[model samples]
Target: MTRSLPLLAALLALVATTPLHAEGDPESGQRVFNQCRACHVIENDGRNGVGPNLHGVVGRRAASIGTFRYSANMRELGEQGLVWTEDNLRAYLANPKAVVPRGSMAFPGLRNPAQVEDVIAFLKSRAG
Candidate 1:
């Protein structure tokens, strides 16, 4: 048992240093936002596109943009008190359909965890 102590200590140290999710990079997230521009916009005073303008979406309730029509599922989720917290955004971005079944968002979800984090970071930065 004593012979394995050093190996165990090293393993624990490695695990402690490794991040479960990469810290988000807003700049990289800006580039990622290009993929969303066809359907959504994030700038203040930005007009709604195929989707609603997402100027202050970070803490906004789901389906709260009045100008844009939301699906029943999304509205229901919002009515149930679903706020767009970072953790909620992370899960939703990973699988929007899973988060709001039968929602109208047609794009497939972001599969890369780092990219999701970065996008969330960018959204948070622009949430003002």
Candidate 2:
């Protein structure tokens, strides 16, 4: 039992250091983000396409991009303080309309949970 303590400690340390959104591969996420290319871009200082620019979007407030117009509901959510946390992103990605009924975004949703995680991971990578 004593011999295993060091291993356990090492594992715990790794868990503590790993980011919360590190479950998915950033590279895989980049590819997955291709699905969003039609409406959004994620590069640093990228411009908004059909959808709002997603650079540094993971922790940003909804409808807060002053350059892009958003639906009233989205603006209201921002007024209500809707920060785009990872979990919230997951929910919205799974069902945009369900999360924000009457929003103008038309992409239905990504049904694959893994793909959603990948996209979130990709977005997080863009934050830096």
Please report the candidate that would top lDDT against the real structure: 1
Clashes of each: 0, 0
Q: lDDT of all predictions, in order shown? A: 0.90, 0.90
Q: TM-scores, in order shown? A: 0.87, 0.81
Clashing pairs in 1: none
Instruction: Give one digit per residue, the lDDT tens place, for model 2 in 5-124.
Output: 999999999999987654767788899888889999877777888899999999999999999989999999999999999999999998999889989999999998888898888899
Residue 51, candidate 2: Cα error in Å is: 0.5
lDDT of 1 by residue, 1-128 (tens): 99999999999999999987777999999888889999999999888998889888999999898888888999999999999988888999889998988999998889998899999989988977
Q: Quote the lDDT for 32 in model 1.
A: 89
